[model samples]
Target: MRGLKKEARLPTVYEVIGVLILFIVIMFGFINLLELPIQLALFTSWFMVIGLGLWIGLRYKKLQDGLLQGISNGLEAVLILITVGALIGTWIAGGIVPSIIYYGLSVISPNIFLFATLIICALTSLATGTSFGTAGTAGIAMIGIGQSFGIPLPLVAGAVISGAYVGDKLSPLSDTTVMTASLTKVDIIEHIKSMLYVSGPAFGIASLLFIFVGFFYVGNSVDLTRAEEAMGALQGQFNISWYMLVPPLIVIALLAMKQPSIPTITFGAFLGVIWGFAFQGIPFLDAIQTSYQGYSIDSGIEFMDTLLNSGGMVSMLEVILLILLALGLGGLMEAAGILHVICQTLLKWADNAGKTTLTTLIAAFFGNFFGGAAYVSVITGSKITEENYDRLNIDKRVLSRNTEAGGTITTPMVPWSDGGVFMAVTLGVSTMAYLPFLWFHFLVIIITLLYGFTGKFIWYTKGKEYTENYEDSTVNTTKFEA
Candidate 1:
């Protein structure tokens, strides 16, 4: 945004509102009305945003700079996607995926598989402090195991996402958890305590829901033969063993040590390829091809073929394309002054404790909708709301909690966000398809809003009165340069 911010004037209020409305129209309208692909919707929106930038007098060079900055923000996720694609292929070739499927089929009950998926993924993400790593490893394996158990993929994905996000929000090692606290100068412990009030109940309720709903599927029958068939197919193809888990364990160890995500994931991928070639006796050329293009097999059985035939760098092409379009549009809109003006407008509604909290949540969602990254949205949401929380004498942890409500809790449900894209591609479940099952997320929203309106858990400055004199105080909202 360097050159564009210098050359472009702040957009008029009308321009800002128009862009938001137009984006909604295209995002929801085309997707709902015409059943267009999300990629196409993003493409059309990017095109329209470019037109708006030029109309606002932004030069091409400045616009390009803004676009690059936006893409730079999301570059880490795109890189992970590429490496994860390769990781999946290599893991499959290495006998790691097959081992999980083979052993998992022998034990997990179909009736409680989803409940187990929730707990397993939660522990994994909590331990590793990464939703992507959990998803690409355990989450993906759970999906295969769930499919074998005659469970629905969407239901399994819902459980995986619920567990992954729960851990990501709570873990001290998580970027969002750390970032949210740092932004407000609130202690990370205080931040975690604040979130637990709402998240605790949501997690409990979601666990039960998964259990109850999972049992409903067993209404017909639990055919153990289906699982046996899958296990047999896996055993026939690979030298499945308990130690095959070591590769994923290395991934967990590296992430826990806070290594760079791109290289860690890349190392995991290469290790899988080498392990597959060395141990599985897969041909050198075939292993190399699987690492690049993807694993392919003609296992005669349709379901087995679908489950095993996946991965490679090439598979992430569409995900990479969507990331560029969404982030590029976000960058252009911000450089054109649309996002800045939008932030300024939203602050006008934060005149009281309830309104202030509500505004924080809305702003988080707005930032995420336009920013294409949850961590970036955290910056915009918390920065814009920080002053208001101070003015109201509300605890800064309140700001951190509410901001995370949008920034982390509901992010995976927003299809255009990086979090959403990763979940969709990894689990093979669309955001909308898995949304209903993200019971914890929906419950958190309701509870967070009630906390804001009812003044429950809205801790104010301890030695000060809960002041209602916000009117006499002069207020100013600084524009966030996201």
Candidate 2:
């Protein structure tokens, strides 16, 4: 018993692969063919992973520790989810959301709406270094505005996601941005420049595509009756003044000051509660209640009421549950040496810089797929591939860039991921619905892949110095040792 306790069994590659194949099939089948909630699939998968852990000679206690550690990786995101929910609910009751909608309907041209939504969200996330805030605030308003113009909500959501993610990727204040930089041992500025090399063109391409697609929706906006009615209802219900913007401004200011996200967002939520009482003439108790249960109204205008009635602490319960289960499943996989076995199998094929980069990306992606958090994914990807990168003489910054491209940018596409679940729940658009239209993310990932194969942005480091070969841009890591 003591000998067994001292060391856990390592599962063979065959065991891990068989379990993974089963997990993927069931996960997709539950989500697609059965049309069941993802929570059920995640719940079911947790048990299967636990069985694997026990079968591989790992103790239940060790597996539980892995689960807790995985959940800890997302503890920040969990708090943000809860806080943002209350912020949304109270912001609506306080007239903050409506003000944006009221003014958005007044000035935003339908012809340029999609293009405009992308840019507005991009800038907001860029400044605040938060996609959740950008989407929950400006993205919400963009949805209402786009719907008023008769545009499909999914298209608008795609634009919002593209803009939000792009800005978050490049923002100096973003946690993922800094994490990816530090793990690769690269200067943050150099890391940002390397990402810009790929993301910049992807953004330009996405912008052009949005601009072109914006014209197609021109017919939808020709009749502004919905817009006119929404504006009128917004004005009748709330003050619709500039002061509504103050809450978000304060949240942004706090974030700018490098305050942690949890308290900053919570402060914004309570501020909304105060505004609901002061400006909307609601009783203090009722306003606070809205923060817990979400805002509600019988405004006679169906769409206006639907648009405005959202956000609350309770509304985030399901998302929180998903996070817990997903992280638990990730923990089980990690503790049983399942992910390590798979990553090693994947690394065997990484013979060249391009292949190594691509393999590193797939590993990062699988980290999100199985690890269930960006922090773990980025760290796991960087650590697993660091040795291969050193052996191949490729710069680790490129590895870091690939990590973000796969780990962070592509996170919102995975339904079980924290980012994916949050975006889907917040924007009222399913991840699958908006996924096809995430032009920027898709473009950036594709560009990163191309760079790996064609050696477009692949950089080589010399010896142990980690300095780039500035004079010889064509220095090839694939041939560095050959």
What TM-score would you give candidate 2 relative to the actual structure?
A: 0.93
Candidate 2 per-residue lDDT over residues 1-482, each given as its tens digit: 65444345667788888889989998989989999988899888888888877775667887788888888888888899999999999999999989988888889888888899999999888888888888988999999898887888889999999999976798888999999899889898999999999999999999999988887756545569878988888888898899898998898888877787788888999999999999999899999998899999777788778888889999999999997778777877777777777776777789888888887888888878887777777876776776677777888788889889888887888888888889999989998999999999999989998999998879987646443332342222211110
> What are the runs in model 2 whose C-alpha is more than 4 Å off?
1-7, 218-222, 463-482
Q: lDDT by residue for model 1 over 80-188, one digit each (tens)?
A: 8888899999999998888887877788878888888899999888877778878988998999988877777888899999999887898888888898999889999
RMSD of 2: 5.7
In order, the Cα lDDT scores of the candidates are: 0.82, 0.84
Residue 419's lDDT in candidate 1 = 86
Model 2 residue 254 CA deviation in Å? 2.1
